[model samples]
Target: MTSKRVLVAYGTEHAATAGIAEQIGVTLHEDGLDAVVLPAVVLPADDVDDVRSYDGVVLGGALYAGHWRRKAKRCAERNADHLKHRPVWLFSSGPVDSSAEQHDIPPVRAVAQQMESLAAREHVTFGGSITSHTPGLIAKALVRHGKGGDFRNPERIQTWAHHISAELAALN
Candidate 1:
């Protein structure tokens, strides 16, 4: 049987969200799914392949000031028709602390609206990172203020990916 094709697309500022998306893609690929990871910015362009071609999609974005990145929002809006017909999951990457790992963080208002629009299966909030390497004056200031560290939990991310794989398996 042909493996299910899954798209893992994300929008990131300092690449933290991209790291999470790549980890999800790797987990899905290991579970026998054909996973393609890409930046949200490219998904909306004319030259890109249609979102309908994929059997499922995992869309994620970096959260800033309680809002998802613009590219991620635009990607969801542009592909709303196709995404609504498929199995879709949404995620947000933010919270520079352990809050996400400590508890279930609900999606922000905009993300929730997108989830409703796409009828997404689930939405997860993952902890973000702000390190010395993260560019931007704000990031530097945060780091200087001792609020910088990588908070993405690999085990949690893999578990979610496995859940997605199981769901897709059931669909087939």
Candidate 2:
């Protein structure tokens, strides 16, 4: 049988969310699925049409001030119709701490709305990263204040990717 094709798309400010998306893609591929990771900003203009080519999609964004990045939001909105017809999962990467690992962080208001509109199967929040290397004065200030670090949990991310793979396998 042909392996399922999964699109792992992410919107990131400093490549943190992209790292998460890449991990997910790698895990999915290891599980024998065909996974492609891409930045949301580079998604085709005819997203609805392009989205149809994938068996499933995992959409993620970097959160800033409790809002999803614009590219992620726009990608979800543009492909809403096709996404609703397929298995969809959404994620957000933010919180430069262990909060996400300690407990579930519900989707932000805008993301919640997108979840409903897209009928996404699930939503997950992963810890983000902020470091001195990250651009922006605010990021540097946060790092200087000892509030910045890479909090993404590889084990948790791999577990979730395996779960997604299991679910997709069941569909076939």
Candidate 3:
């Protein structure tokens, strides 16, 4: 069988969202699927051409003040027609906290309704990285970010990967 092509795109200000997208692509690769994780800012034009090139697309990004990254959202809106017709999934890497088990429902999550409400097969919230842990994101000259390490749950990521894999399999 021909390997399936999946585009996992994310828009992030500091790279936390990009980290999550990369992990998803790794998981999909483990399942022997053709997956490419593209940062929304650097995604190639072919990434949004049509549904024919990819079996599925995963839209992911960070939420700030209750909204997905603007560029990521626009990418979705532009491809709304294809997303509505194909297997689409959305995930947000936000809700900052120190514990992986803590599922803090940030009030800002409501702003992501557009992606969830617009015919996506499913959506999930992820524990985001702490600014304390990600030092390189800000500035390295004057002072180190002073901290590093994401609080996001690896277990939850694996579980979501399993779910997406199953759903994509079902489609094939």
Candidate 4:
């Protein structure tokens, strides 16, 4: 099988999002695609192929204080000219506690909407949250607000990755 290039880029404050992005890259590779993971912050300077050059691109960002890190959204938005012409997917590793957070999906809708307007092939939520051990400036503050739980589910992640792989295959 010939490999189709896929870029899985992400931004994270507590590293959770990066882990998920890496998992997706691995999943893609196992499915016979050439996948790479990169930090969204490093994109503007990296020699990596531009968004338009990939067979598919998946962008993920962690949600903090009701927002996906602005840098991730901006990275995707700034590449709209290229992204709009290629298969793209957007994910927000969001939801501290679906039962608690006022907004279930977080504010990634704005970024998702932009992708939709650009005709992204698909969009999904790989739901994530602050675990008890997650510690940092922002994560610490999140805990202060009563956010603590392992909301991540491996099954869900795998299913999403499978769907993305299928979508890209159909595109080709």
TM-score of each: 0.93, 0.93, 0.76, 0.79
The digit string of per-residue lDDT tens for model 4 on 1-172 reads 5668888888777777877777888787777777853323223212234576577788777777567776677777677788887887777776766542233442355766766766866666666768657877676777777766666667667777888898888875
Give the Cα-based TM-score of candidate 4 against the true structure. 0.79
lDDT of 1 by residue, 1-172 (tens): 6888888888788789989988999888889888854323213222334687789988899999899988788888888989999999999999999999999999999999999999999999999999999999999999999999999999999999999999999996
Worst 10 residues of 2 by lDDT: 37-46
* Candidate 2 accuracy as TM-score: 0.93
Off by over 4 Å in 3: 37-51, 98-100, 104-112, 132-149
Q: Which runs of model 1 end up more than 4 angstroms from their true locations?
A: 37-49
- What are the Cα lDDT values of the candidates? 0.87, 0.87, 0.67, 0.69
The CA lDDT at 142 in model 3 is: 18
CA deviation > 4 Å runs, candidate 4 = 37-49, 98-107, 141-146
Look at candidate 1 and tell me the lDDT of residue 78: 85
Cα RMSD of predicted structure 4:
4.0
